[model samples]
Target: MARTALALREAESAAGRLRSELAAGDEAATRSAGSRLAEQADVARRHSDGWGFAALTHLPVVGDDVDAVRRVARSVDVLGADALPPALGVLETVRGGGLRSEDGGIRLDTLASVSGPVTEAHDASTRADRAVAGVRSDRLVGPLSGPVADLQQQVQELDRSLGAAEKAVELLPAMLGAGDRREYLLVVQNNAEIRSTGGLPGSLSVLRAEDGRVELGKQGNASLFGLSADPVARLTPDEVDLYGRNVALDLRDTNLIPDFPRAASLMARFAEQRGQQVDGVVSVDPVTLAEVLRATGPVEAGGVRLDADNAPRLLLNEPYQRLRSNEEQDAYFQEVSRGILDALLSGQGDQLELVRVLSQAAQQRRFLVWSDSDDEQRRIEDTPIAAALPRDEGISPSVGLYLNDSTRAKIQYYLRYDADIRSLGCTAAGRQQVVAEMELRSDVPDDVARLTEFVTGDGTYARKGDDAMNLRLYAPTEGRLQALTVDGEPAGIKVGQDGDRQVSVLPLTLRPGESVRVRALFETRPGQIGDPSLQWTPSMEWGPTRATARNLCG
Candidate 1:
C-alpha cells in the first residue's frame, strides 16, 4: 500500500513537470519528465493491481475511491507511455502552421491527418471520466475525502476539455466549409447597455465561409430586425413573466433571457424573418475584441485607432459619448466591429494567440456561439462556448446573478459587481447552509445627473445617471431561499423557479457612487457539493470579486 501511494505521488508530480516542460518547448526536459512519469505510473499500476490492493478496493466507502485511484494510475500510465508522443507531434504540426494553406484557409487534409492524436487523448479522457464518474465525496472518510474529490473533479474537467477539443476537430472541416458554403451571423454584443448573456446585440454582420476561407458579408445594426407586432419567435410564459414581452418583441432584448442558446435561437429566427439564412450564430463582446486586438496590433475603425488598450473603452463607453442617437451609436458600433472583424479575418497577427484569447473569452462567457445543426450543437452543448444557463447536471451546483438594464440608457458601462458565498455548515444527510451576499456599485461621478442625456435616459425611470436594472439571483438546483435582505433591512423578492433552481429578482436604481448590497440565506439541497461557485454577468472591467469556501460542510 505504501509503495503504491508513493509511486502515485511521484507519478503525479512527474506529470506536472512534463506539462510544464512541454509548454516551455523544452523537448529534452519533456522527454525526461515523460519517462519518469511512465515509470512511476507503471509501478503504481502494477502494485495497485495486486491481489492485496484488489481486495482492499472492495472495502466500503473508501473502496470506490480506492478503485478510482487505481483507474487513475492506469490512465496516467497509458497517457504517459502512449498518448503524449502523438499529441506532442500534433502540437508541433499546429505550431509550425501546418494547418494553414497558401491562401490562408485551413488545409482540410492537414487537419484530418493531425486529429489522430486528439482522438487518442479524447478516448483516454473518456475512460478516465467513466472510471471516476458518480464519486460521492460526501460519503468518504476523513482526510481521504478531499484528495479523492479533487482528483475526480480534475478528471471530469479534463474530460470536458478533451471532449470539446475532439469534437471541434471533427466538426472544423465541415464548419469551415471545406466543400460547401456556410453563412453565420456575427453579432457584436454591446456591454454598455448590459443584457443577461453579455450585452445587447448592438451590431451584426454576415460572414460567409467557403472553401475554408472566410469573408465578411453585409453589415447591419439591431434596427434591421424591426420590432414585431408580436414576438419574432415564441416564448415561454416564464421568460415573458420574468423579463417581459419586450424580451421577445424586440431583437435587442432577445438576450434578456440569459441563456445564450435560447437567445441565439431567437436571434436566428429573427434574422431568417429579416431575410438572412445563417448556419449558426456567434456573439462576442467588446472585451473579447480588446483581447483580439492584443494579438492583431492596432486596427483602424471609423477613422479611429483601436488597440487592446482603448478598444474596450471606445466600444463600450465612447459611442455614448460621441454618438448622439441610437442610429449613430449603432453605426459607430458597426464600423468598429466591422474593422475588428476585418482585422481578425485578415490573418495579420499570431493566429495562435488569437485562438487562445478567443478560447479564453468563451470560457469567460464574453464570447458565445450557437449552431443550427443539431449534431454540431450536440458536440458543443456541454462546452463553455454554449454559455447556457446553469443546469442541474454538473458535479458542483452553480449560483448565478444576472442583471438586465431597463433604464433605457448606456449607464451599465460604469457598473461593477462582487459576490460572496460561504458555507456555514450542513446536515448529516447532505443539506447545506450558505449565505450569499452580492453588491453592485455605480462608478460614476458625483454629478451623475449632469452627465450626457443619452447616458442618463433623461431620468424617466430613475434619477439622471441612475441605472435601473432588473437583478436576479439564482440558488443551486433544489435549494431554498430562506431569507433575503437588501442593505441591512429585510426585503421581499419575487421568487420563481428556472427549472429546479429558485430564482429571485428585484429592480432598483442606484445613484452615482451609490452601491446596493444584497444578502440571501440558502438551505442547499441534499446532494453532492464540491468547491463553491458563482456566475455573474460578464462585464468590460470584469470586477467580479467572489469569495467562496473550499468545502460545503465544516
Candidate 2:
C-alpha cells in the first residue's frame, strides 16, 4: 500500500512537471529537459508500483491483500484517467459475488484476484486479457487514449505479475514437500566457469581480475588440480548454515540475464511447433488462447489465413518447427506487410509510360553549329547520336542547352532532358542513359552570374553519371570578370565586372571518366540610356559551339 501510494504521488508529480514543461518554450533545452524528467518520473512510478506489488505477497492478512490491490488499482485509475473509467465500470459489474457465476461451481470474474500458486498465475492471465480488451476498444474510438492507456497500464501490471508468478511457480516446486532435508552441499567456484555476464555484474567483475581466484567449500584452492589449482571444495552443513534461508546457497544472487527467458521461450515455441513435449517451460494454455481471442481478435492457423472462430494454437506438440505462435505470427505479418505490397505493384506499372514521352522531346532541341577549323564555317558540326535521330513522336526526344563561363579556362552548361509524362513511370535504370550528357544552361543575363550558378550546380540540374559537357562565355566589353556569385554566395572563379555586365570562365573540361554539372547566375543594372538592349550571351564550347540567348526573359 505504501509503495502504491508512492507510485501515485510520483506519477502525479511527473504529470504536473510535464504539463509545466510543455507550456514552456519549445527550445532544445526545454525539450531535452522535459524528456529526461518524464523518463525519470515514469521509472520511479513503475519501480514503485512493481516493487510495491512484490511486497504485497508478504502481506499477512487477506484484508491487507485486498486493500493493497484496491490501492494499486485506484492509483492506476488516477494515472490512466483518460482510459480507466469505462474499464472500471465494466469490472464493477462482475465484482459482486455470484454476479457472473453461471452454475454452482467457481466462476471467474472479469476483474478478480485469487490466492495460491495457480490462482496467482490465473490473476496474471486475467490482467493480460483486460489489457487486450482495453486495446481493442481504444482502436474502435481511433484514439490510443483513455481505454488504450488503461490497457497499456494493465499490461505493465500483468508483465510484472506474470514474471513474479513464473518465478514463484518454478521455485515453489523445488521447495514443496522438502521436510528439513539436508544433502551434501559442495561449493566449487572458479572464474573459468563464468560464461556470459551482463548488467552490473559485467562491470563489477573487473575487480576480480586479480590472479583469477578460485575457492572450494570456502577454501581457496591454489594447488588442487596442478594447473594453477582448479578450485574444488566440499561445503559442510555447518559451513553452509550461515545462509539464513532453509534453501541451499542463499548468499548467492540470482543472475537476471534476459537471454535466459528469451532462449527458453524460443525453445518452447520450437518444441510446440514440432509436436514435441517440453517440460518446465510456459506452454500455451488452451484456456488462455480462448481468453486472448475473446479480448483481442481472430486467430490464424499455419502461415496462411485467419479464422474468426476455432483458433489454432502453435503448441509444443506440432509438426513443424515454429519460432513464434500463430497469434504472434499473424500480428507480425499484418504489422510488417501494411503498405509494401501496393508500392511495388504500382511502381512497376508506371515505368513503361514515362519512357515514350521523354523520347519525343529530345528531337526538337537538337541543333547543328558552324565549325571555325574548317574553311566553310557552316559545315556540319559535331552532335550526339541521339540528337541526329529522325523526328519520331513515339521514339524521339528534344534537348536544350544553356551555358555560362565559370573560370579562366572552362565553362558550365545546364542541359534539360525534358520529357512530358503524367507520372514517374521510368525505372531508375531506364532513365539513366538519357539524363546523362543532356545540355543544361542558365536563364541569367550576366556571364559571371551564370558562371557562378553553374559552378555551384544551383537552380536546377540532373543528378546523373553522364558524358561530359563544355561551357564558354563571350565577354568582349569587360575583359575577364570577377568570380561568380550564386544567390549571393561566392564561387571559386575570378572574373572582371563592370556596370551592368560581368563574365567569369569555368572548368567545363569533361574527360571520359569525369561527370560534371554547370550552373550560372547573372546580376546587372538596366540598360544605359538610349541602349537598345543589354545582352549577355553565355555559350557552350566543346564538340559544338552554340551561344544561348541571355537576358531575353528579363
Candidate 3:
C-alpha cells in the first residue's frame, strides 16, 4: 500500500515536470521525464492489480475503495504509457512551424506526420476517460470523492482535446486544399432577426483554398437575392411539417431547422444553382467574428470601425437603424464580414490564441463547419461544432428550446431570451422528470415607435415594435412532454415531430417592455439517468449568459 501511494505521487510529479519540459521545448528532457512518469504509473498499477490487493475489492465495505484505487491506477497507466508518447509527438511536430509555413499556408507534411500520433492519443485518452468515469460516485465519499471527481474532470478534458486533435489532423488537409482546391460557402447568420439555428443567413461569402492557403471570393448578402422558384432541396416530411416549406424556398430561412449540416446542404444547393461551385459550408455569426477580433484587434472596414466589444451591436442592430436602405445595410454587413474573413486568412494574430478563441466560439454554436463529403463530415461528428439536433443517445438524452422570429424586422435585437431546466428527480425505473422553462422579454426602448421605419417592421408582419416569436421545446429522444404552461396559464400547443423526437410549439407576441415565460414539463425514458441540458438558439448575443438547466438528481 505504501509503495503504491509513493509511486502515484512520484508519477504525478514527474508528469507535471514532463509538461513543463515539453512547453519549454526541451525535447531530450521531455523524453527522459516521460519514461520516468510511465514507469512510476506502471508500478502503481501493478501494485493495485496484484492478486493480494485485488482480493480486498471483493470485501463488501472495502470493495468500493479498492476498486476506486484500481481504476485510478489503471487510468494513470493508460494516460502515461499509451496517451503521452503520441501527444508529445503531435506537440513537437505542430510546434515546428506553429502550424503555418512562411507562405502563410498549412504545411501538409506536418499535418500528415501528426495524424497517426493524434489518433493514438485520442484512443488512449478515451479509454482512460471511461475508466475514470466508472468510479462509484454513489459509494465514494468525502476525501475519496474530491480527488476522483477532479480526476474525472481532467481525463474528460484530455479526452476532448485529443479527440479534437485527431479530427483536425484528418480533416484539415482536405479543407486546406492539400492536393486539391476546395471552395466553401461562408454563410454569416444574423441574430437580429432570429431563426432556429443562430439566425437568418444574412451575409454570404465564398472561401477558396488551394495549395494550403485560403482566399476570400464572391461576397454578397441573402437580402440582395430573391427566393428560389423551386425548393433548393427536398426536405424530410417532418422538417416540412414542423418548419414549413419556406425553410427551403427562402434563402434567409434555410437555417430555420436545427440540423446544421442539413441546413448547410440546402444553402449549398442554393449556391450551386446560382453557378457557384461549393465543396462545403461554413457557418458563423457576428459574435464568432468578434471572437476572431480578439487576436486581430480592431478593424476599419466598409465605413465602420469594428472591434470585439461592439461587434454584436454594430453588426446586428446598428446597421438596421443607420443604413438608409436594405441594399445599403446588406452591402455594409457583407463588407464587415469580408474584412474579418480577410484578416483571418492573412493570419494577423497569434496562432494559438486564434485557435482557442475560435474553439470557444464553436462551443457556443457561433461557429460551425459542415462538409458535403461523407468521409469529411464523419470526421466532424460528435464534435461541438457539428451542431446537429440531438437524438436520444443512452444516458445523455438531449432537450431543445429553440426560438424563431416571425416578424420580418430587426425587432429581435431587443429580445432577451433565457432558459431554465430543472430535474425533478428520477422514478423507480430511472425515468427522470424535468421542467424546461424559458423567459423571453422585450428590452425594446420605450420610444421604440420613434425608431427608423426600416428598423421596425414596415408594419407588414406585425406592429412596428412587436416581436412575433415561435418558441419550440423538444422532448428527449423517446421522451414525451407531460404538460405545458405560458405565464402560469394553459395555452394552446402545437405538437409535432422532428424525426423520432417530439416537439411542442408555442407562438407568442411580445410588445415593447413586455415579457412571457413558458414552461414545459417532460419525462425521460427509462434508464435515462444522465444529467440534462437545454439547447437553445443564439439571439443577438451568441453566448449563454443565463442558466439553461439544473440537475437535482442527488
Listed in order, each prediction's TM-score against the native is 0.84, 0.18, 0.84
Judge candidate 2 at residue 225 and give its lDDT. 12
Per residue, candidate 1 scores C-alpha lDDT tens digits across 375-419 of 888878878888888675554656777888878878888888767
Q: CA lDDT of 169 in candidate 1? A: 80
RMSD of each: 4.2, 36.5, 4.7
TM-score, model 3 to reference: 0.84
- Write model 2 residue lDDT over 56-161, tens digit each, in one string: 5566643343333333344333333322223223223323332222322122222233224334434544554443332222222222124324333444433433
* Steric collisions counted per model: 0, 47, 0
The number of clashing residue pairs in model 3 is 0
| Candidate 3 CA-lDDT value | 0.78
Pick by lDDT: 2 or 3, better one? 3
For candidate 3, what's the RMSD? 4.7
lDDT of each: 0.76, 0.26, 0.78
Candidate 2 wrong stretches, greater than 4 Å: 1-121, 124-147, 159-163, 166-170, 180-554
